[model samples]
Target: MYAIVEIAGQQFKVAKDQRVFVNRLASEEGQEVSFDNVLLIGDGDNVTLGAPAIDGAQVSAKVLKHLKGDKVIVFKKKRRKGYRVKNGHRQSLTEIVIEGITASGAKKAAPKKETKKADAPKAKKATGKADDLKKIEGAGPKAAEAMVNAGLDTFAKVADAKPEELSKILSEASSRLAHIVTETWPKQAKLAAEGKWDELKELQDRLDGGIEK
Candidate 1:
């Protein structure tokens, strides 16, 4: 018997005792994981297909190990601009062996329910003060609000964020704030978090609208 299952956003044809490598899962080694998104199951001449995914059908596997794939180099260049960048990346992966495949009659696991304490009343929302992120160069009220909403409410949090992460957050926020440059936000936030206002001022003066001038 064989089954087509979706694992970690990818699909694969798997059979009993077959070993497969997939995107990294949160499960630890030797832990069992089940995939309920089975698309099709076949045995001999009989086959069952799901409209989207089979109900109650599941494919079980045991995580064998977690490892990183080979590195891939990324190179970029702009002609006559004296701009070039090079980077490398490796993808995390998990190896698993198929243990069993159940076409139907498997009971889905029940979700655990939270037990609220009877003595606890509804908690009030926090109205406490947060850092004024707008003080940072290139950050406006909308950008600050977006950062706060994304849990970067403190200068330290903003300082610890990478430029790529900050760009992703701003892009998800709104188009009005999409054009804002973040190359120097982390540096400025780090200075602010350290209470070095004079140094931050000097740095901002050298920067043109948050871009290194």
Candidate 2:
């Protein structure tokens, strides 16, 4: 069987035991990482597709190692303006081998629903642990995932994160996240960490979505 799955920010067609290189991920070497963004799965002539991503479908792989891709030169010039710039960049990448693919009805979060009655405790636990980054303005699912994967999963950590550092992380993850401005994220994260909900709300409103103007 083979499946098209998204890893980091790019998608690839992967099959069992196949080794693939992708943008660097935060998973440790030898650790198993699973992707739920299965676009389609195929086994022989039978094919299953998803509107965006298949529900309950997961692809798990073990990270083999991390390395750098071949360096490429970037050249830019402004004619008549006498402006010329040249640089070289090497992409960070990770090598992973597909372990298995679980098609339909193999939800990973299925066990978490058994204790539905413990929602109250879970809420408190969540509030004290790795906070939901989505609460911070300017952070959506993809952006938040990038942050969490980089180990800045808590409000306090995010509050202390420098804008330049955060920018580098986002840049390395995907060019799509390049447009996301994080100038005010630390300040907003600080308020959230301190439980200053009112102040955070005020700042987000004043900043007009908590993005740099």
Candidate 3:
């Protein structure tokens, strides 16, 4: 059997158990990932092609290793000027072992939420609660939690938060996501402070390149 599929925004024809090198993905060696952009499938004498993408078809693969591809030498020269430039490039790659193909593709599912379980110790409520706060629009859960721990729970507090204040507080926590707080936290706080929710949404859409609300 042979199938046409898309991987990492590029398309190729593949078959079951085939080995292929693709652009590196965020997977550890020996991990697995699935691809659904099976554009066409053929077995024996029967073949099917999608108008754009094949519906209800899937391909799965396992990463055998992460590797750097063969070096590509680039040389540029201006014959009359005696100028030459040479460079070598190595593309990051993942070596994959095709697992199997399924005609019925996997359905997209909603992301899982934190589950509440009785008998377990009651989880501490997040500290970053602000008056009139609905959601911190661009904040991730851990970042929000850090803000709560710092006693700046509400959007109102965040909006008026001086860069120096946040730097001082979060600097003691962890430096990994510190830059994000400096960049996105102040803007989010301002929106919350002024109750300019729509304006904040507009700014987010602009930054994210989304169509107008």
Candidate 4:
């Protein structure tokens, strides 16, 4: 059976024989780790979603290997200050294969995951015309695409966005989008500098409610 499980504070849908990389643990290779935090369980014809988590449910996995990820080089410098620092780090990881899922809900054998051929590269989808988004003060074409997906297609919409509202809308965003909004967006930076996004959002919400500004 397939199950949704949490590992190292991250949620993942896992099925039997599927290999997954998770945070480093002290288990030896070929050892077994059974997580009792199954969130959901699914069979061939039935699916069960947990209320936060399922009781008496577990997902067992076998540790295949312990390895380090690719090395990352960190460099820091102060321009014209004659100060520089360099460091390298590799994240420890554990690769585990899902073995079985057990619960009172249902039972189903896991299906083999489809593997993509190495020779066939995935195609990239075009976002939109770059010029359409480049005109915004702080948004580029990629950022505009992200905004559009988040239901903000106009500059006025961005200007009226509340920080918490924006955060909720972009909760599924990649780290790149988070970094762009937190570190790169000029108007957002200005609003953050003035600490006015919350107030702005409140005003926008009131306006939408037909309250006079």
Report lDDT (Cα) of residue 162, candidate 2.
91
Q: Write the per-residue lDDT of candidate 3 for residues 24-87, one digit (tens) a residue.
A: 5545688888877788889889898887777778889998996777879889999899999986
Alpha-carbon TM-score of each model against the true structure: 0.55, 0.57, 0.49, 0.45
Runs of candidate 1 with Cα error greater than 4 angstroms are 111-213
Q: Give the TM-score of candidate 1.
A: 0.55
Candidate 2 has which clashing residue pairs, if any?
A: none
Model 3's lDDT to the true fold? 0.65
Task: Tell me the deviation in Å of residue 42 in model 1.
Answer: 1.3
Give per-residue lDDT, candidate 1, residue 146.
Answer: 82
Which candidate leads the pack in TM-score? 2
> What TM value does model 2 have?
0.57
Give the alpha carbon lDDT tens digit for every residue of 101-151 in model 2. Answer: 999766564344655535434222233467898998878988887887677
Error of 1 at 93 (Å): 0.6
Where does model 4 exceed 4 Å of error? 77-83, 105-213
Selected candidate, larger lDDT, 2 vs 4: 2
**Candidate 3 or 2, higher TM-score:** 2
Tell me the tens digit of each residue's lDDT in model 4 across 1-213.
789987744678999889899755445688977776678888988888888778778888898986778879889999999999986656566799998888854333365345532332321222442124334333456556665666555445555666445433333343233312211233543443466758545543433111122
The better-scoring model by lDDT among 1 and 2 is: 1
Which 10 residues in a row give candidate 2 its minimum summed lDDT? 119-128
Q: What order do you get sorting by TM-score, best first? A: 2, 1, 3, 4
Question: In candidate 1, how many Å is residue 184 off?
Answer: 22
